[model samples]
Target: MLKLIRLEWRKHRFAGNFLGAGIAMIGILLFLIMIGFLDQGTEDFAFLDYQGSFILIDTFARAVFIIFAGVLISKLIISEYRDKTMNVMFTYPIKRHKIIAAKLILVFIFTFAMIMVTDIIMGALLLAVNQYYGFITEPLESKVLWQMVVKYTISSISAAAMSLIPLFFGMRKHSVTATMVASVLLVSIVCSGFSGSNGPTMSINSIIIIPLTLGAVGLWIAALSMVRLETKDLN
Candidate 1:
């Protein structure tokens, strides 16, 4: 398992760095722009709006990050099949289950780490700017920060898990990129319907209920499909 993880890490090292750097760069840029505006001396920084700001930022940035994560995980998993490299992989004495597990573990780790790093950079910038400008009069609660971190992490994983549908398609047809885009589009449709009045109608609880249920279902489906793939014919 360790060897499989090491092998997967080597395969994805460059891509992982690119994804992490992209997240950091965008996060820092956003933080800078927000601080720059706040520093213009006309506006006061009030933490009263922090909750709304957190939600808005989480909605936009996390959505983008999740899409990136979906693409990264799909590409990582499908690359082996798309290139017909699995045959060479199978030549080694490694177990197929281990390979799948390694991929899953690595994707989770990479996505989680990237997100945390983004948060840390943003938080540090906020702290520094608040210190000098006294824009935010109230102290920022650590608990709120932790909650945002947790929520973003879970959201990213859920998005990555949903990418399994495309991973399945990629495994079967070897068209990783096409399958990934299709999967993301499908998820977007579902999400849009959930929020639309004329679309999939449900109770108020449906908002919270539906997404949590779907996330759980995606995780389960991914695991089952992975297990099935380990034993099924790859040719």
Candidate 2:
């Protein structure tokens, strides 16, 4: 599986994709850093503390990576069929399902890794900048920091699975555009209310069940997508 994943990375534009992801993360971090200055007059707002800022970043990062996963799928799987490039791969001694599974697994791992990495990097940067700027409204507690780690780990896992949901859509007609659209729509629906409302204000990471459920569905679809792979015609 690792060998297959490595080959996929080599075969695709993963280097450029990683570069794009890094640029996206930097943009997200900068925009978040500006929020403190932009909301100076408001009595209360988001990104004012470790907890709020962490949730906000997780939402943004997950949404971004889901799209990344979609693009990876297009390049790794959808484009293979659209361009008839996978026929070459189908000639290999390996089982067809293994090839497909490797691609999906790669997408899953990439999404999870991106979400966790972005949160940790952005969180640390915020904490460091807050030390000098004092823009974050509250002090971060050791307990709260640990909580963020646990939550992020679980969320990343769920999001990684959820990232595969677009495979079903893209495979329907081998449409890369549909895959892209599905990913953005998935993010909009899943992350739109990430920090749910409680009374008049918001609560951080309040709803995890939605992603968990959707992620399970994604896994199911991913498995189902391979059911016919064994006898699929490359001709």
Best by lDDT: 2
| Candidate 1: stretches off by over 4 Å | 14-20, 31-48, 131-139, 142-165, 186-211, 230-233
TM-score of 1: 0.68
* lDDT, each prediction: 0.57, 0.81
lDDT per residue as tens, model 2, 107-179: 8887898889999998888788778878665667799789879988998898899889998898888899999
Error of 1 at 217 (Å): 3.0
Steric overlap count per candidate: 0, 0
- Pairs that collide in candidate 2 are none
Per-residue lDDT of model 1, residues 33-137, tens digit only: 775576445333222244433433334343444455566656666766667776677677877767777876676566556545555565566567668967555
